[model samples]
Target: MSHLVRSGAWVAGALVAGVSLAACAADSAPRPIDESSPAPDASEVDYRDGEYAATGWYGSLPSHQDVALTIEDDIVTEVTITTPAEDPTSLQHQQAFADALPGEIVGQQIDVIALDRLAGASGCSEGFMNALAEIKTRARA
Candidate 1:
């Protein structure tokens, strides 16, 4: 019985250590928002006049969201969000997006737009950022 107990303790310790290491590695990974990395620009659009989908996460949380972005002449004209948000009460994101989206994409390149600004969005902002990232990655592909 003592041997079994010791084995179980060792297993649990190993599992805990493994999880901690994984978490630390993820936290240390390079982020997409690093200022040193070149920003994605709209001019990189080789294909235009189509709708694309993007998916993103809120930091490292399990929460995720999706966005459908329309590109015209390398500019994001329309963004149709497929997933709403984690919370129902916060609808500020939709309104803020309605007000700022057009101006945000005007002269800027499609790839350049980062979720950095939207992180401030009230409820669904993080999800929106993740979705936007996914969309841009897809567009570039």
Candidate 2:
């Protein structure tokens, strides 16, 4: 009876080993690459492609700038900032920031766009970034 049980156990072990070998052979077989799925770079971006606009206000005096941006392929293709500067000094700073804006952001990825002390306008940079956050929200995919 003991011999019979031992032989049965050996047979079960043999069956398990056979199954494992079959599985290993299946794993080693070449599988065709799935080309149906889009490549990571070609996949849809989280932010939708389109023109977006937002108004951001900053400073103790609370100046405002209207930010408009065009996004294609998750990158900023164009940008415009309309500063309703109430004073000449503020207008000069805003204009400086606006002039520097296109070069800095036009070719940048939208998700990573931010500025600090651009064109010597620290306050304008702050307002621009604040507006960009809103633009990102509007452009969310």
Instruction: Give the alpha carbon lDDT tens digit for every residue of 1-141 in model 1.
Output: 011111011121110111111222346666467788676554545644567665444544344434556766666665544334444433344445434544555445576766546425533465555565555555654
lDDT value for model 2: 0.68
| Candidate 1 accuracy as TM-score | 0.48
The residue-by-residue lDDT of candidate 2 on 1-141, one tens digit each, is 011111011121110011011112347768788899845652345788877767677787877677777778888887766756868888888887888888888888876776878999998887778778777766878
Quantify how close model 1 is to the true structure by its C-alpha RMSD in Å: 17.0
Angstrom error of the Cα, residue 77, model 2: value is 0.4
What is the Å distance of residue 106 in model 1 from its true position? 5.8
Instruction: Kindly provide the TM-score of model 2 when superposed on the true structure, using C-alpha atoms.
Output: 0.67
TM-score (all chains, Cα) for each model:
0.48, 0.67
Clashing pairs in 1: 40-111, 40-112, 42-109, 42-110, 54-135, 56-130, 56-131
Q: Give the per-residue Cα lDDT of candidate 2 at 63.
A: 75
Error of 2 at 136 (Å): 0.4
Question: What's the distance in Å from true for residue 3, model 1?
Answer: 57
